[model samples]
Target: MSANHRPREGRPAIFVTGAASGIGRACAELFARRGWFVGVYDVDTDGAQAIAATLGKDNAVAGAIDVSDADAWQRALAEFWVHSGERLDVLFNNAGILAPGSFEAVPLARHEAMLAVNVKGIINGCHCAFHYLQRSPGSRVINMASATAIYGQPELVTYSATKFAVRGFTEGLDLEWSKFGIRVSDIWPSFVKTRMAASFAQIASARALGIRLDPEDVAAAVWACAVAKPRFHKTHWTVGLQASLLAFATRIAPSALSRQVVRYLAR
Candidate 1:
């Protein structure tokens, strides 16, 4: 493996968005544990700094960034590059929100907020990180997509739509950035036991189905995607057994069958 593929002194670094709590926080901690300098960026500055503190002052840099704002993304990543010797090995667009309820029952503001943070967040992060990622050999982008990307859910319709947008962007960028030697990939994990998951009204189904995943599980997958070989670079990394099974089924199953399965799960 190239030195860039793993964390080394002042070289490999990862910046995680929404690093306050939940999956983003977990990703930042895992990368730090692996010896990578981590940037904890979030709208919640206190939460961001708390994560950085746990990682140790020398191991992490904390910044508050609202991912929907392109300018903020540029500024935060610029600082991150400076801290890591201008190197960026991975950019984890792990910040997102879940709004669960009937589409019309949810306020329009909530829908718009979801779009800004979940969809535009990925766009802003990838666009701003492009130059840094290009400079770092074997660099990768790991977007936090959900199983909802495979199909729409009534409760999380807006959130599902955002993930679909992320999945499309990951595929498009993977093709576009390959010439630049940057690997782009997305992850599809089922409901994880985070504050975000608990906020979902239909979260009980995951418990009923006995398929709730842990944040560390997805964190492990993020690390795997970060260092995966170019030849073995998977476009979509699915976490947990249910996600793995659904990924396989969706690829081979008919559209109608998958749609039916989605409806069943949302029940």
Candidate 2:
């Protein structure tokens, strides 16, 4: 059953958190195309199931579970192991959301939910993945960071903070996970087209903060990192030309960059 698509030897199962949509969906699709056994986990059961169905029984397994839930992670992994019969070769921590508003305007519940789903979810995924990731040599984990991690976005201070946390955690894990032969990389994507952010105003506002990576483009980056030789890259590849420039300029001249951001975002 397993050899029909991917190689019969070595770990070929790839567990993708947030696999129902956006960058995660793309990564799942890429891995499935290569005959890899893909375990698609997401809160959206229908979305995950649709992707798995398209990939065929030999290549993909779909499960609906929120990455933020530790227990859910355990249950989903148990199911994937039973179904796929292999440890995850690659894990993409890609479930996240956009909280757009000023600090004062945003509710505490929204903020907490964002932190739980974005920051804590990655932490939980990493912890849940340890044993499985250790089972395979050269297994990889890709954390979804952002250009905002490089600097502050006035309108998105909280979101920026979470991404910075992801960047910090990924860098730290890259060193700690090396002994287990699991390569940890962060994908810093810019504004991507996804249902998660489906509003034109949202897109326009994001441009003001320097984000512009199409979902497919970021997905390609994830696949590239998975097959590449292991390396500790504290700063991974970023998409979106505008966002990349903003990130670079923010480092060279933060004050100047902030002013530009204000001007661009202001009507």
Candidate 3:
């Protein structure tokens, strides 16, 4: 790490993937303002650098990383460890992509891309950052999942599947990593007003529910997860009213009824 990148002693650190924009950027800003060192990593080098510059050198470090690439994840984490004083207080797996259209209309490659980033990316981050998190007391991993994970959505099949994977991974890991003092949690958010959401504005579900959440709304949930006291079973945090209602319905409603509700909204 460069002189400017050296960690500030006693400042908690967070490594946020996809920190160039959207929810990731919001989390970075919020964390930095709250006196945490931030690692801003994204595939967009310039954008990541811009965010770092905005946050100031002492407060943040920036790097380019394609979350789908395991080697890139390794390199980014290694560098982050240096700047964060070997601390990984929070690993925010917020980088993900989506393709909304008829399931068949979206190309297979795009679906695979979504899986690589949304699912594999979280796996890579959690697996690679294990030791750092183990060393830091009260470390937590936060994965960005979608409300679509509550039930499959028609136009968002692959993206929904990926979040379901994240949800499962977070649950399993939280149990497995408890011995290491690492808590794993995922955030479930309904559509947010971001460029990514804009791309799917025409989808029936988006048209019906509307994009009521903002990036900051989801970021606040992430912050909550970061500071929340550990619990035996609180592994999922829903970000919006829609997401909370959907999560509640899935728990109480019959499977057939839940399916019909999804169908009605997605129609």
Candidate 4:
């Protein structure tokens, strides 16, 4: 570690995975600006380092992590723990991948990769960060779930499934981890204008709904969750008008009706 990048003492810290780009980068930037120590970790080592550097040496540290790999999560968090004054205020499980195509058309490997990064990644993160979160007062885990989790999206079948897994995982941990004072929450954002979203921009759902939310928009929601009072009932945070609407519909509408609505949008 460079002299300038050495950890400062006594600051709330956030460990953000997938911090090389998109929502992760945006959240890291937001929290650092708000006087929080930030750990920017991504599989893209150089990109994560670049982001950490931009956040200023004293505000941030950078590391390489492939979130699906359990061992890697341990290593990254261990390094982050040292720079963060041995405290982890928040762990943002923001790393994920998507494969948008007909279920059969998308390659099995792509689907499996999506499951690894999007679903297993969160499991690895929350499990690994359990102790750090338990030790830190008011610590939270924020998982990146998608609006597709509201209902099964046609073209985004596997991706949608992974988010549903995220939703369940978040809810379960929120309940289970409360004993340790570690609140768990997840963000549900519709299509966002990121490189990942661009890959599926031409999909039917994207064409119907249009990508409105930006990375910064979701980052703002994460910030809200990080600072919000610990309410046991309030767990999932939705971003963008469309995501909010979908989340609302899922609550009031019958399953059949909700399915029709999603089918129409995904057609």
Count the clashes in each prediction: 0, 2, 0, 0
Every model's TM-score: 0.93, 0.87, 0.97, 0.96
Instruction: Report the backbone clash tally of model 4.
Output: 0
Candidate 4 runs further than 4 Å off: 1-5
lDDT of 3: 0.90
Model 2, C-alpha of 263: deviation from truth (Å): 6.6
- Model 1: lDDT equals 0.85
Predictions in order: lDDT: 0.85, 0.77, 0.90, 0.89
List clashing residue pairs in candidate 4: none
lDDT of 3 by residue, 114-155 (tens): 999999999988888898888899898999998988998898
Per-candidate RMSD, Å: 4.2, 3.3, 1.4, 1.4
Summed over model 2, clashes come to 2
Worst 10 residues of 1 by lDDT: 1-10
Per-residue lDDT, model 1, residue 143, is 93
Candidate 2 structure quality by residue, lDDT tens digits, 58-96: 777788788889999888877777666666778888889
Q: How close is candidate 3 to the true structure, as a TM-score?
A: 0.97
TM-score, prediction 1: 0.93
Query: Could you tell me which 10 consecutive residues in candidate 4 have the lowest summed lDDT?
Result: 1-10
